[model samples]
Structure formats: C-alpha cells, structure tokens
Target: MTVRPILETHSPSSDPSWWGAILLGAVFILAGLIVLGDVVAATVISAFIIGIVLLVAGASEVFQSFSAPHWRGFLLRLLVGLLYAVCGLMLVSNPAAASVALTLVFALALIASGVVRIVQAVEYWQWFGWLLLVSGIVGIAAGLVILSKWPVSGLWVLGLVVGIDLLLHGFWWITLGAGLRRDNRAITA
Candidate 1:
C-alpha cells in the first residue's frame, strides 16, 4: 500500500482580502465596549436604550409579519412581536428592574444558543461532539452563575461584563472593517 499526499491548490500569492473582515470585527468590538461603558455609567440609561431597541425591533417584526405572504407564519411572528413589545414596555416602565430581566434574558439566550450549536455540531461532525458539548456546558454554567448573582449581580456585574464585551466587540469590528476595506481594494486591483 502506498500513502498518498493530499494535494491542495493555492491562488497566486496576492494580498489576502481578509483585512476587511478583521477591520469590521474590530469596529464591532469597539462598539461593544462603548455600549458596555454606557451600561456601567448608568444601568437606567442602558435599560432605556434596550427598551427603545426592543420597541423598534418589535414594531419592525409586527410590520413585517403583517406584510408577510404567509398568513400562518405571520400570525406567529405577530405573537412574538407582541411579546417583545410587552417586554419593552416593562423595561421602560421600570428601568431598575431591567437589570435582573436582562440577566435572565441573557442567560437563557446563552443556554439556548449553546444547545443549538451543540446539536448542529453533533449532526454535522460527530468528531466535534466534544467541542460542542463543552461549549454548551460552559454556556449553561455561565447562565447558572448569572442566575446565582441576580439582582445585585445584575446591577454591577452585568454592566461590567457588558462593557468588556462591547469593548471586545468594537475592537473586533474595527479589525474586520479594516480587513474588508483592504480586501475590496485588493479585489479591485
């Protein structure tokens, strides 16, 4: 039996266009940081912003659902939109409560995302099951930690975490944006 080498093809050496993506990522990281800072400075302000965002998003969803061609899907979306609106209203009505609510929401989302990722990994790459499982476990652990520190933790830790995340995201975006710009130039060239 002869061992065969895996042959790979490479494009001619040219400037890689990944710079734009990097720059974009950096910008996002920076934006995340800014948002995190805002959250830290005033949780109320952050809550207000979140409320406004939710309101806008919910309204958009409702409008889209109404305009959708599929009535059944539209109805479902409308229900979701209503829920979003209610949550947004609650946040606005009592910004102080937003911290706890946000924490719970974040934890739930993390766990849900982790589960989805794990499932996808299991289906697509059995060999990667461990990776996905670990990710899911981490997400669940994080959620549990957040839940344990709710209220008081929601007030201080949440803001700090959000700020750090924002900072990281902004940096990521900036890097991605720059990379994209570079790639666009290279493509044009």
Candidate 2:
C-alpha cells in the first residue's frame, strides 16, 4: 500500500474546457472595465456611495443584533452597529469630508493590519508567514506614503485601489474556473 496526496497528479489529458476559459476571460474583462470606470469617477461620489452602503449594512446589523435572543451580545452588537450607522450618515452628509475620513480610516486599517501580520509572522514562520510579513511591510509603507500625500492621494487612490483589486480578483477567478473545468474533465475521463 502506498500513501497518496489529496490532489491528483497533472496529466496531458487534464485540460480545462475552452468554453469555460473564454467565459472566465470575458467575466474578468467585464470586471476590469467596471473597476476602470469606478476609478475614473470622482472620489467624493465614491465616498458618498460607500457611505450609503455602510449606512445600510450597519442598520441591518443593528436590527439583527437587537433581534437576537442573547441580550448581552445583542446590546454590544447594537451599540457598535449604531456607532457605525451614525458615522456612515455623517460621511454621507458631507461627501468631501467623508472622502478624507475614509482615507484616514483606510490608512489606520492598513497600519493595524500590518502590525498584526508582522506579529503573526514572528510567531509562525511557516506556511507563507514570511510572505504575510512582506505584505504587511508593504501595506504599512503604502499607507505611510498615502498619508504623506494627504488629500492629493485620497483623490486618486480609490481608482487605483479598485483597479488593483479587480485585476487580482479577475485573475483569481480565471485561475479557479480553469482549474475547476480541468478537474471536471478529469473526473469524466
């Protein structure tokens, strides 16, 4: 008896469907276009849309939290949700200020995430921990650079960030779809 890996070894017959690849590619192209369009839009408008989304999400969370059976947890969640809702509403009230606020929030979040990642990397060096550390450093550096640029960076950063996100997501989707198609074919064969 021999032990085997969970993933099957690749073979020449294990080819992804052409149709699936084309479909995935089309979706990726669409996503890229949407992100590009969003980037071209004014930051204030983006901020306003974000504010509205936040407001809706917070309100829904608050309602769900309060409706829960556990009073203590409900109270805690409700309070947090209320705070978020209020902040979101404030942002929507003044889109200009909201954009600045969102930028600062993003900077802080990036810094915090970087610090957490660095700590985790120090604790666990295996399984892409080093990659996490490098990413954290890059994130912190980027946040600092954005902070230094202030309002100017805020105006242009949203589009660039969205573009990068869409690109990464599209790539991931294409890869996953291809892999799935390949696996499906392999199973059939």
Candidate 3:
C-alpha cells in the first residue's frame, strides 16, 4: 500500500478555498480587537462561558455515573461531578471572583515556569542560553507585574492574553493563506 500526498496531486493555489482562511483571519483580528477594547468585560464573559462549560460537563459526568450504577467508581465519579458543578456555580454566580482566583494561579505558574526556564538555560549558557535567559527574565517580570497589581490585574490579564492570542492566531492564518497563494503562483509559473 502506498500513501499519496495531497499536495503532490493538487496545488493549493489552484483552489480558491484558501481565500476563506484569509477571510477567517480578518474576522479573528476584528474579534481580538473588540476583546482587547474591553478587558474587564472580556474577562467576565470568558469566565461565564467557562462556568457554563463546566456545568455541562459536570451534568454529563453525573448522568454517566447514574447510567452505570454498577461501576465500582460510580460513587467517586458522582462526587467529582458534584464538586465540578459546585465550582461552576460559584464561578457563574461571581465571575469577578473566579477571575481573581484564576489570575493569581496564572501569575504564580508564570513565575514558576520562568524559574524553571532560567535553571534550564544554565545547561546551554554558551549557545542559545542567552535567549532563554532573556525570555525567562521577561516572563518573571511579567508575572511580577501582574502579581504587584494583584486583584486589579486579574480583571484584565486573562482578557489581554485572550485578545493577544486571537491576534496571533489571525496573523498565522493570514500568513498561511499568503504562503498557499504564493505556492499556487509558483506552480502556475
């Protein structure tokens, strides 16, 4: 059996479908801009959505446990599901508080990651270690800045991160589309 590569049979530029990627990228960029415009609102909305997802997941887990009552772990699963539901309810009830708690955890994780990166960089100090060290420093600095702002930073950090992510994703899609178009042109020529 032989596997055929799709690209070998058809050029990306030959198909007009790549245009959709560019269009989607534009939409993502627009959404990202909107999210960035109101960090507080974005954070709250994000938390609410997460809470809803958790609620749904918890309900599903509980239902699954009940359906298979003979399973040895049924009691444990039910308890875990209940815990998830309670936590989800808490978040939905007060997204602002949930954001604060989540942000603190994020900041702490960033700091820990930076520390680990710095330590790892020591093994390659003669090569690209400097780059790693710089990245670690930046991470630590960012984490410290967020921590300094504390609860206030919580309101905006998650939203800012999400907006930046959307912008980067949009750029990636646009770049991919451009590359595909270029490849198509090259193939035709």
Tell me the alpha-carbon RMSD of every candidate. 8.7, 7.1, 7.2
Per-candidate clash tally: 46, 0, 0
What's model 3's TM-score?
0.70
What's the C-alpha lDDT at position 185 in model 3? 37
- Candidate 3 least-lDDT 10 residues: 180-189
For model 2, the stretches where C-alpha displacement exceeds 4 angstroms are 1-4, 9-30, 38-42, 65-70, 73-75, 108-142, 168-189
User: Which prediction has the highest TM-score against the true structure?
Assistant: 3
Instruction: Compose the digit string of candidate 1's lDDT tens values, residues 1-189.
Output: 976432223221233445554555566566556656556455666777788888888888898898984767877899889888888888888877786777777767766766775675466343334544555566666666777777666665556555544454345344434444443232221
User: Compared with the true structure, what per-residue lDDT tens digits does model 2 show for residues 141-166?
Assistant: 76777678777777666555545444
Q: Least lDDT summed over 10 consecutive residues: which range in candidate 1?
A: 5-14
Candidates' C-alpha lDDT: 0.62, 0.65, 0.75
Winning candidate number (lDDT): 3
